[model samples]
Structures are given as C-alpha cells and as structure tokens.
Target chain A: MAMDRTEEDDNLPRRLLDGCQRDFPLTPRPFGALAARLGTTEARVLDAFRDMRKDGLVGRIGAVYRTNTVGSSCLAAIGVPLDRLDEVAALVCSFPEVNHNYEREHAFNLWFVVTAPDQARRDAVLDAIEAQSGLRVLRLPMLEDFHLDLGFKLSWS
Target chain B: MTPDPIDLRIVEATQAGLPLVARPYHAIAERLGLAPDDVMARMARMQDLGAIRRIGAVPNHYRLGWRANGMTVWDVDDARVDALGERIGRLPFVSHCYLRPRRPPSWTYNLFAMVHGRDRAEATRQADLIRAELADACRAGEVLFSTMILKKTGLRIASAAAE
Candidate 1:
C-alpha cells in the first residue's frame, strides 16, 4: 500500500527526493547514473536538483555521518523562563558546536545538539551552555540507533 | 572510528554536499589533490565502517510538505526498549528512532522517535499508532512539535573533529 502510494507520486523531482535519499549513485557520473535509473537525461536531473536546492527543498546531497563515530554529540535540553526562551535559544545557537537547535512545545523548550572532537570537549560545551544560560541542561546522548537510515517516503495523495 | 587525515579531508570536502557536476568525485579529488578513485574508495570504506550512514540528498521535510515535525518520546520498560525501539524504527512514518538514557525526575523517556506529517493531526495519529504498537510496555509518551528552528545547519566536522 505504501509502496503503491510512492509509485503513484513517481516523477523526476519526486524520485530525486524519495528514491535518492539513500544509495545515491557513487559512480563517476552520479547525475548520469541517477538519470539512467530514473529514465531521464543527466541534464534534466541536474537541472531539477539545482532548482530544488535553490528552492530550499533539498538541504544537501551528501553523506549523513554517524553521530559519535567520527566525533561526539549529545542532545541537550533546557527549561527556560517563557519570557527568556528566545534569548536563551539564540545563545545556545551561537556556539559553533551547536548544530541543531529548535524551540519545541514543552517545559524543556530549548533543545539542541552539540558536536565536538571528543566526549571531553562535548561535555565542556554543555557545561559552558549551562554556565552562560544559568540553567540546567539535560544531556541525552543516543545510546543506540534502531534504524539503519533516516529516509522518509513522501505521500502525494 | 576516527577518520584519518585524508579521509577527514574527503569528509570535509563533501560535508556541504557532493559537487554538482558530471564527475562529482573527480571534482572533489581535484579540489583535494587526490585521485577520483581514491576518493570513492575512501568513501566506500567509511560507509562500511558505519561512519557514513548513507550518501544521498537530505530533503527539508517542511519544504516538502511535511509541516508537522514531532519528536515523540516514550517511557518504556528498560528490558523492552531495545526490542521496541527496533520495531518503532521500522514504522513508515518514523524517520529516526533511538534509545537514550533517562535523565530522571524531570525526564523519564528513554525512547525517542521522530515522526513527520502534513499537519499536527496526522502527526498525532502516527504517534497513536506507535502507542498501539508498544501496548502496555509504554507507560507514558509525549510528542514535542518543533515550533521554530533556531539553528539547523547539519554537522560541521572539520572545525570540531580532532585535528
């Protein structure tokens, strides 16, 4: 059923977003290979990708490195006063090590991921955030990943 | 495993994205002063090492019409979390699923799964499906819908990784 839904939405641009989420051709002419698989011209694939990228639909075409494999990172959250939420979130986002920061609907509103060279450095980053914000930061490093990939099959219905 | 200096260079070069060209690897190799074959071989090795999860395009879910992004956390029995997490991770709607340590009193959820939907109602409906899958093992659960993206540039390795 899900497969059928995906097949229904099959097109050059949709395939690029859904099909190429993983196992993207690693050949010399990747665009050519993708074009071959999708039954389109290499130029068409490239143009479609460029357009999607320019439109902010595609973040990037790259490798999704495993967290804590090459470096270290942890998901930490902080509960800030409602009034101070935006100010604190900005402070958290200022750190280069802090890659992803989001304002969620919860008491622990400010959530972010901090990446560093090693465990020691990662801890130091959390500490600095704590010190600067004057609030406790809850560190939740991933213990295990149950999924092999983060690919999502889009529905066009 | 830590990437060697050369592999690190390869990672850094492609971190932003593979070059938009006919021969992307050749482009990376030319810029890094390495052979195209060498670049591809190193990336393949990195993928085997589990250092590179996958090589592909990352779509901006919101821009793709997945507006409701929910980080659904659940409190499950410690003995059953790993098993349940594996099942949850396979769900069509769950983009990411992992087991993280419980921070206690304030934070007791050990399971975190990311679900995307076109709207909040759809996102909630997906969460309910996971709840049904977990059955009695799930003691509590809450979906944290992201209200704003303060920062969202993917990981920066060259600057932070060991030199």
Candidate 2:
C-alpha cells in the first residue's frame, strides 16, 4: 500500500514532464485540458508548473525551432589565453547571433553557436570574431543532425 | 522558407516564451491583434512545416539533477559516419548527436554527442559506454566537460526580414 502511494505521488511530476514536452495542446485552456488528463485541477497543474520553473527544472514553456530551418547556424570554438578568457567570452556574447556561449575543459576553451539569416552572414560574423579576438576560430558546421530533440525524460528517484 | 509577416510577428511575440496562463494563445493573439484561432492555426502550420519543432516545456537538465554534461567528440571514418551517427543517436543517454566538420591540425573530431548525468563520474561512464559502442570506427575521442555556461538564450531571428 505504501509503495503504491509512493508510485502514485511520483507519477504526477513525471506525467507532467512527459506530457508537456511534446505537442502541448494549442487550446485556449491548455492547463485545464492537461489537468483533466492528469486527473488534477487546472490550478494544481499550474501550481506544479510554477514550482518546476522556480526550481529550475523547467527552462520555459516555448517553441523550439528546427536547426538551420529558420537561419544558418554553426558551432565555433576559440582557444583563448587563460588570462583573457573573460574578456573574449564577453566579446563573443555581445553578438546577438551568438546564442549559447560556454567555457569547456579543453584547449579550445571558449565555444559558442552563431546563428544568422544566411550562410554568408554567418561566416562573416565568424571572421569578425576571429579578427576581433585575434584567435583562430574553428568552425564546425553540422554535417548531419541525428538527434535534434533535447528534451529528456525526468526520472524521479 | 522565408516566413511571412504574420509568422515573423508570431515568432517575435513568443520567442521569449508563451504566457503561462489558461488561455496563453488567446493572450498572444490579443497582443498581436489577431484572433486566437488564427494564431493557433499558424503555429500548427509552422510546426507541420518543421519551422517550429514543438510547442512545449524545455527542461533544464542541470537543475533536474543531471548536473554533469559531457560534450563527447569522436573522430570517426567520414565514410561511415552517417550509419554510426544514427546508431549512437539512438542511445538512451545521448540527448544530442551531430556530425560536424573536422578542422585538421587543430581539430580532428567529426562526431559530437552530448551525454548528461548526475555527476562527472557518471558522465564519464556514459562516454566510456559510447566509446565501446563505436568500436574501431571511432579512431579517437575526447569528452569536454562544460566548466561554465557564460550565456544561454533561445535563438531569435530578426523580424526585420519580414518587412
């Protein structure tokens, strides 16, 4: 009985996570529909969503665009000097085209993704970054995208 | 495909996020000066055309306890990469897998897979599993752990193109 209760409790968030990650209803009252399906109230569903967002579990309720469908994009990396990492990273982030910029444990420490309306513009931005930072930019455009979906199932342990 | 004025407007309006309310699309329609059904229809069409992958919640893996993420890169034979990439992508633990161009002399990795785990050790373990899975087709591999996320934002194409 205790195990059954625990399982029921665990399924709530799991169901919420799994349900919302794909084809969220386009209805006016989506939460209400979701609540009906989950055997809960709209307020309860909304509350859970709020809590999840607050806890950082949920990034956002939004649309994820297909890669290179909306614009040209490429993965780029630069080997910045340790002392100038921050300055270079800030410079990289200044570009609105650059969406994700991160420091990784590698010789090519600073990496980012640049998105532009066209291939020519994207390459131009890369060249500009290389010239500004005085660093050789390694452009690694996606030859094939195997798994595009980043959403993963949440395991409640 | 170049998006129409209406599509661009919709993207700009909701790029940050859809309002978290009972009638989110209605709210979006109100802001855009369009009817709710029109907004919904356009969104559905965009999704069908693959302009929008999905309308849903994006979970932050780091906050969900998958704190360690390994950006695993592998140097696989270019000829056989498509077949191997497909197999590697089917792995449950691998979230994102892509075949990227390899720049010689500095970079020789053509395959990239992102594996996430609760800790660095777990991430490493997953990378090892991928190594074993690749067998001989994978000539060399390295797992670059992300030290910090300096900036992370959803891509927002300029609505200027609409005009």
Candidate 3:
C-alpha cells in the first residue's frame, strides 16, 4: 500500500510534464482544465508545477521558437586559457545576445549561442566578442535542422 | 520571416514563460494591454507560421536526473548528411540533431546530435549506438559533455523588455 502511494505521488509530476509539452490549452482556466484531465484539484496541479519550478526540474512554461524565425542565432565557441576561463566566461555572458553558455569538456571549452534581430546584428555580436576577447570564435551556424519530437519523452526510471 | 511588431511583442512577453496562474494567457493579455482573444489568435498564427514551435514546459534535463549531456559531433560526408541527420534526429534518445558548418584542420565535425543519459556510461553507450548506425558514412566523431552551465537564459529579443 505504501509502495502504491509512493508511485502515485511520483507519477503526478512526470505525467504533468510529459502530457503538457505541447498543445497546452490556450484557455482562460488552463490549470483548471489540466486538473480535470489529471483527475485532481486545480490547486494541487498548480502546486505540483510550482514545486517543480522551484526545484529546477522545469525551466518555464513557454513557447520554443523555430530558430531563425523570430530572430537569427548561431553556436559559437572559444578556446580560453585555463587561467582566464572565468573572466572570459563572464565577458561572454555580459552580452544579452549570448544565451545558453556552457563549459563543455573540449579544447574549445566555452560554448555559447548568440541571437539577434537579423544576420547583420548577429554577426556584429560575434565580431564584438572576438575583438574584446582576442580569441578566434569558432562559429558553427546551422545549415539544416532535422526536427525532433515536439515533446521530450521523460524516461522515468 | 520577421515577425510584425505586435507578434514580436507577444513573443517577447511569453518567451521567458507564462505566469503560473489559473488563466495564464489571460494574465499575459492583461499585462501586455491586449485582449485575451487577440493574444490567443496571434499565438495560433505564430504556430502556423512555424515561428513558435510549441507551447509547453521546458524541462531542465540535468535537474530531472538526466545529468550526463553529451554533444556528439560527427564528421559525415556532406552529400549524405541531411538524409542521415533526419534518421538520427528521430532516434528516441537524441534530443537535437543539426547539420552545422565545419572549419577544417581543428574542427571537422559538421553534424551534431545532443544525447542525454543518466550518467556518462549511459550517454557513451548511446553515442556508440549512433556510431553503429552511421557506420562508414561517419568519418569521425567525439562526445563533448558539458562540465558546467556558465549561463542559461531563454531566448531574449533586444527590443522586447520584460516587465
């Protein structure tokens, strides 16, 4: 009985995240509708999501744009010296256009994305980063994107 | 295609996220000084135009226990890459697959597939599976696991200031 209860508790967040990935009802009482579908109260549904967000399990309930549609973006990397890694990273993060920066395990360690209103603006941001850092930016622009599943299926272990 | 001013405003408003309220869109509409009907209609149109991919929850995979994120880069033959990339993109474990430009000598990888797993071992196994699928078409490949997230913010537009 305890095992059953635990499983039931675990299922709510997983179900909510998996089920609401796309086609989220664009209704006035969206949470209420979601609660009805999940066979729970509206408050409980909201609480579950709130907890997930606070815990960092979910980033946001928002729209994922098709790249180059709303704006232009490209993946860029820099091989910063180990001693000056943090300083350069802070500099890279200073740009509003630079989003999704990561320290990946590679020779070209600092990887980031730059998005701007148009190609010219995007290129300008890249150029600015290069001029400031004095590091050659490895620009890997997407030539083709093979669309994947709209909703990421969570593998519940 | 560039979104008109209104559509751009809507994207800017909700790009961060929808408010976690009973009437999320209605809340957004009020905040943006637009009617609920207008907000819904515009969002639907954006979806139709492929500007908005989908309206949903964006999960932080690392926090969700898929801790190991491996970016597998492949140097595949340019002629056959698109066909192979589509197949690879459809794989259950591969989250994002794209054909990117390659710079010779230092960088020869033109294909990138993001693979997520519970740990390094699992992610490596998944990469191995992709290698087998590619066979000789893939000249070489490497998996670059992220050591840290220096910064991560949702897409932001310069003109659209968040309230």
Candidate 4:
C-alpha cells in the first residue's frame, strides 16, 4: 500500500514545478531550495522525484514540447451522429500521425490534430479523414498561435 | 516498457479533463479513490518514461488579447536549422519550435515555429525577428490565422480499443 497522506504532502509538487523552470537557482544544493520548501531532505526530494517517476506520476522534467513548430499541421473536426461518434472518430484517428484526439459536446462531434510532414501531406490527412469518416472534415488551419503554453499548476496538496 | 494499471488509471483520470479548481490533483484524487501523492508520484514516473508529456495550460490566445497568431513555416538549410531553430524558439513571442518529419517534394520547409502577438502587425514583427535570424536562408514562409476555433480541450487519453 502507498504511504498515508498528511497535510504537508499537498504543498510540494507545486513548489518544485514553480521553481523547476522559471526561478531555478543556479547554485549548489539546488534540491536544497526545493527540499527546504517541500519539508523533505534534499535526498528525499530527489528520491521522491525518482519514486514519482517509478510510480508514473510525471511524464517528463524537461521543457514542454510545442506541437505546432514542426512541418505543417491543422485542427480538423467532423460532425458524426451520436450513434456513429465512436466509429467515425476511430477512422479520423486511425493515422498514427494524429497526435491529439477528443470527443467534444459541440456539433462537430469528434475533433483531432493532424500534423503532417508538410502542407500536401497535411491536406491529404484531412482528405483521408473525410474519406474514411464519411463526414465533412472541417479544416481550420491555424493562422497563428497567440498564447500556447502547456504549463499547469499541479499543487501537491 | 509498457504502462501498468496505475499508469493507465492516472492517464484515464487526467485524460478525461482537468478539474477546474485551485487544486486539480487533489480533486482528481477524490474522484479516482487514490491518494493525492500517489497521483503525483505516478505523474512523475510517466514524465520519466516519455509515455506522457508535461502537464500545463492550454490558454486561449485570442481571448487573452493576442488576437493575431500564426504558424510560421521555414525552409532552412539542413545544416543551419539547429542553430536558427534555437534562436527562434528563445524569443518570448515564439511559442513552439520543432523539426518535423521531412515532407519533401511539395513542402520543403522542415523547420517550423509559431509566434503570437496582440495584433497582426505585432505578430508580423515577432516573425520578422525570426526572419532576420534566418536571413536569406528562410526561402519561403506563410502565416495563416485562425478564422474559427472549432474545438479545443485537454487531450483525451482513450484509445478506440478502450471502448
């Protein structure tokens, strides 16, 4: 069984996450800064990070990968009926290159991101989605990414 | 390595949607019947394996006053792409940068980046900074602004086979 939770446990990840990137101090005992705030020793904090990784809590401790900076990509959606939502979505999502897929409550039932090696392939993917799903694949190519940041505040409490 | 049940469970919970609150993980813990620390620990582990990416926000740029946003594609020479990409990505205006799988023949640009600004001219200036760095190496480029936002959300972790 996992260890029992205490109130103190809830305030650690947020601190580390906050300090990890923006205000990371460049000095010895780097973990000390985090450890001091997290109420655990530097080693425990380090070990905690190791344990978290072992436990599958975090995906990475690096820079967030921005999805739009590659070849060519577009956001596409299709309005599948409630009955065929799953079926049509699967067809749209069949391509391995489709990075993100979602089931939205909006009129266009299934939506996903089609990122290709280039514009032609990008359009081809949309065409393929339309062909396979039998639904109008509304292609909304991004004009600009005004504010895209994947940084979420994961409070430890 | 393959993911464990706990891994799948964490992904399932996280994938469904983010709990709108000051403390989402704790709320997620309440919903999933697992200790909050357990959730955090599992997330740390997934981060290590690269099975999942970083956890962060999906802000609406347009709503935030950055009315102009464009996905800028660059046709940089293979040799200089690395350096130019680094410079482009460092600018606060540029949100994303990556080396995509080379889709040649029709599309020649391998280096891609995005710059968002409060308005069209501002966005163009942000792109200009990148353009200056590339100089003539930037053979061609284009900016396509979003006409409509069809759908946007946190990623869903479910595979079709899940159902």
lDDT of 1 by residue, B54-113 (tens): 999999999988999999999999988889999999999999999999988999999999
What is the lDDT for A127 in model 4? 87
* Model 4 TM-score, all chains together: 0.54
TM-score of 2: 0.91
Worst 10 residues of 2 chain A by lDDT: A1-10
Candidate 1 vs candidate 4: which has greater DockQ?
1
User: Each prediction's DockQ?
Assistant: 0.69, 0.65, 0.75, 0.07
Write the residue-wise lDDT of candidate 3 on A33-106 in tens digits.
Answer: 88788777677778888999999999998788888888899999999999989999999999999878999999
lDDT of 1 by residue, A1-157 (tens): 1223233333678778878989987789999898777766777788888888999999999888888877789999999999999789888988888989999999999899998867888899999999998999999999999987857777778
lDDT-wise, the better of 1 and 4 is 1
Rank order (by TM-score, best first): 3, 1, 2, 4
Off by over 4 Å in 3: A1-10, B160-163
RMSD of each candidate relative to the true structure: 4.4, 3.5, 2.8, 11.6
Candidate 3 accuracy as lDDT = 0.88
What tens-digit string does per-residue lDDT give for candidate 2 at A13-92?
Answer: 66788778877888889888887877776776777787888887787887887788767899999999999999999999
* Most accurate candidate by DockQ: 3
Judging by TM-score against the true structure, name the best candidate: 3
Off by over 4 Å in 1: A1-10, B158-163
Clash totals in order: 0, 0, 0, 31
